[model samples]
Target: MPRWPYLLCFLLICGLAQAQSLYLHSPQGPLRGGVNEALGVGYFLGIPYAQAERWKAPLPASGWTAVREARYFGNACPQRGVFTTRLGGYLPPQSEDCLNLNVWMPLAAPPAGGWSVMVWIHGGSFTGGGSGEPVYDGSRLAAGGAVVVSLNYRLGPLGWLTLPALQAEDPQGSVGNYGLLDQLEALRWVQRNIRAFGGNPQNVTVFGQSAGGMSVCDLLASPKSGGLIHKAIVMSGGCTFVRKLEEDFTFGAEWAQAMGCPGADLACLRQVPLSQMYPPEGSVLANVVQRVEAGGFERSPWKPHLDGAVLDKVPLQALKEGRAAGIPLLAGGTQQELWGELLSAPGDWTSFEVRAEKVLAGKGKAARALYQRLYPERPREAWAYFQTERTLLCPSLEAARVQGEWALSYGYLVSYRSSVFPDLGSFHGIELPLLFGTQNTWPAQAIFLSAQAYEDSLPISRELQRRWLEFARVGEPGWLPYDSGKLLEMGSELKITDNPYQERCGLFR
Candidate 1:
C-alpha cells in the first residue's frame, strides 16, 4: 500500500509495454491494447461496442469469433466545427463507426479485493474529444489504487440528430441520442467483463467533466444505468436543458429539411453523409451548441431526450421527482469559470461586456436591465461569475439538491489552480489532471520531466484519490452532504459554506 515508490516504478516503464497483449472478452471479438511503465498498469484502448447505419440509430456490435485488434484506436466518430477536440490540430482518419472505450488496470489486481473502477466520460459539449487524448492518461489514477476507464461518445449531428421522421421508423423507432446509447452500452460491457481486467463492476463510479458532467447527471436519472454504477462524481457542470418529446422529434427534421433531405423524412436523412449533417454556420442553434461542437462532423449539442427507456424522463424532473438512481454523489465547479471558458479573453470588462449583454437578453428585458444596472461596467468578475453559474457552480449545487432528496450527495468546488496555465483562472476542465494526478503526463511529456511540477501535484493527487476512492468504496466522499442550507467547500483547507455561490448565482434564482 506504499504509494510513491509503488507508482514510481510504473512511470519508468511507460514506452516499454506499448505492444502488450490486451485481448479481452467484449461482446465484440477479442481486443488488444498497450501497456506503459509510467502508469504501472495494463491498458486496452479504443474498443468498439456498437455500430450505426449511416444516419440511422446505433445498433449493438456484431458478435465475432476471434478477438478484434483494439490496439490502435478505432476512428473517432465524425464531428463538426473546429473547437476543442481530443487531438485538436492533428487530423487522423475519421469514420461513422466510432464507439470505443479505453481501460487502464493495475498490473496486479491488489490481491483479492481487486480495484475500484472509475469510468471517465470526456466533455466537448458531447460533440468532440476522444479517449486517446494524452491529458486523460489513466496510468496516474490507476496507479493510485484504481482501474480507470475513459470513453468517446458521439458528438454533434452524428450523435444527436433527433427528428420526428426518424422516430416513425421501426424497432421502437427513434433517431438521435446515439451518444447516450453508446455510454449505456459501454457501461454494460464494463459490468459484464471488467473483472477480468481486475476491476470491480459493482463498485463502479461514473465520473465526467462539462458535457460529460451532463451525462453523469443523466445517467443518475437513468434506470438502465442504475445498479451498473454505484457512485457518481461530476465536475465542470451538470444538465440544464431537457428536450421535449415533440421538440426532440422535430429538431432533426428541421435540420434534415435544411439538408435537402426529402420532405425532412427519415429515408433522406438516412442517406445524408454523417459529415455534412451539422447545421450551417450563422444558424441560431449552432451558436448555442458551438462550444460543444468539434472536428468537422458538426453539431455536438448536449441535451437528454425522453428516450422512453434508459432515459425515460428528463434529468432535472426525474431527480426532483425522486426517479433517479439513488447513489453517492460528489459534485461542483471551479471558483471562476467565466474568464476561464474564454481564457484567451482579457481580464477586463470591455472584453466580456458585449457578450454579457447578449446573454442577459436571453433572460428577458427586465432581467437584462436589472443585470446591466448591477453589472453594467462588466468588471472582469461579472463575466467570470457568469461562467460559474452556467458551467460548474450552480449546476453542481442543483444536482446535489435534487439528488440529495433521494441519495447521499457531497458537493465541492475545485479552488485549486494549475501552476502551468496561470492566466486561465482556475478554469474549466483544469481539474482533469488534478483528479487523476496525471500532471506529469499532460499537454506534453516535458512537464513530467520537470521536478517542480511533479513535486507540487503528487500530494494533491493523493489527496484527491483519498476522497475519490473513499467515495467509490463507500457512498460519501468524506464531506458533509450538500443541501440548500449547508454545503462543504473542499480544498487544501475544508469548510462548510452555504449556497457555495450567489449574486451571479442568485440571478438564476
Candidate 2:
C-alpha cells in the first residue's frame, strides 16, 4: 500500500476511537461528553437528571430523542453570590432551571462488576453553591478507579421555604424540603442511568461537606433514600441538627410579611421578584447572631426541617431509632473549623475569658476552670477550639456515637494547616483541595499552597483519595470503626487517636 494511504487509515482509526470514548447510551437517551486529554477522563457536564415546578417534587427529566451534548455546566440555581476564600470568589450564571448533574469517569474500560460511584453534594449553607465549583472537579478522583458525580439542587427560599399554603399544594403534604427531595430524585436517576456510564448502581457512596453533609444524614434517615445510598461520608456537618416544621412555618409567616404577603399568601409570595427574596447582607448577619444568642446555632430558616412527609421525624431522632442501621458511615471535621472567625474578633486573653464565661454560663465555674486549664496560654486558640467543639466536632461525635452503636462508623480529624496560610490552621473545608487533588491547580486552593507546599502535600492528598476510594469500593475506610472509640487523624502524620476533645465536649452535653 502507498505510504499516504496508510497514514489516512491510521488517522481514521484514531478519530473513531476518540469518538467512541466520548459517547454513552444513558437510559434517558444518548449523551456525548468531553474528554480531558491530559488525564484521559471523560466528563459529561450539565446532564439534567430531573425537573420540577416551584415548590413541588422533582420529576424525571423529559426524555430526548437525539444525542445530547453535555459539554458545558448548567446554570447555577438562583442565588445571591457570596465571596469566600473556599469557593474562589466567583459564581456561575444563575437560573431557576438548574436541576442538572456532572459526571466524570476513566476513559478506560471498567473493571469486573463495575466502577464504584461517588456522588458529591456541594455545600453553601443550603443557600448557594453549585456542582460546577472548580474545587469540586471530579476528574482526578474518577481517574483513580471510581465514577464521580456532582450535582446542583435548588437553593434558598426557592428550595426550602415552608408554609401552610405550600403544604396544601403538595399532594403528599411534603413541604420545606424541596432541595432534599431534589437530591433523592437525582439518586433515583443514578440508579436508572449510571450503569450505562460504566458505574455500579448497587454500590453508590454519597459524600458531601457542610450543608451537603447534613443532606447526607437526611438521606440516611429518609425512607425514600433507603436503596439509593449504600455508603456515606459526612464532613463538618452534624447529624442531630435540624429545625422543626412548626418553626419553619413561623419563619415563613414572618418572611411572607416581610415580603408584603402578610397572610402567607402563596400566590402573592410566588409573584414576588427573585431580587427581593435575598435579604440584605447585614440582615443575614444579624439573623445569624440572633439565632446564636438564642442558643440555636444549628438552626437556620433555609436548612432542612422535619417536614412530616419528607422527614417524618428529626433526623437525629430517627438515627437513634435505627433509621440508618446498616449504612456504613465515615464522619469527621477539621480540627480548627472556626479558627478563621477568631481572626476577625478580639484576640486578647481577657476577651477570651469573658466570652467563655458568657458562653459557658450555667455550666458552672468548674467547667470554665477545666477549659482554661486545657489551653492556658493561647487565648484565641482556646476560644476557637471551644467554638469548633460546640458547633461541629462535638455534634459529629454525638452522631458517630449513635451510628457506632447501630452499624459500622468511622471518624477522622483533619489537623493539617496550609503552609501558605499557616495562620488559618486546618480551617473549614481545608480538606477539599486535597480530596479532589486540586491543591496546586485550582485558584481558590492554589493561593493557599505554594509550589513547595503542593509538592509536600501530594502524599497526604494521595492518601486521602486512597482511603475515600477504598470506602466507596467496599464499605470501610481501612481503619477501626468508631465503635472502637478510636479515629484516624490525618495531618503531617496519620495515626489513630482516642477520640480527642471528648472531655470538653462533655461539658457542653
Per-residue error for 233 in candidate 1, Å, reads: 1.2
**Residue 170 of model 2, lDDT score:** 86
lDDT of 2 at 453: 80
Off by over 4 Å in 1: 1-19, 22-29, 55-57, 86-92, 110-113, 248-250, 278-302, 307-310, 340-378, 440-454, 484-499, 502-509
Q: Mind giving the per-residue lDDT tens digits that candidate 2 earns over 158-185?
A: 8889898898888988899999999999
Quick one: best TM-score, which candidate? Answer: 2
Best lDDT goes to which candidate? 2
User: Alpha carbon lDDT of residue 455, candidate 1?
Assistant: 76
- Position 310, candidate 1: lDDT: 48
151 Cα displacement, candidate 2 (Å): 0.8
Which lDDT tens digits does candidate 1 get at residues 263-338? Answer: 6766676677653565456766455434333322112234556767546776767778976547778888877655
Candidate 2 Cα lDDT to native: 0.80
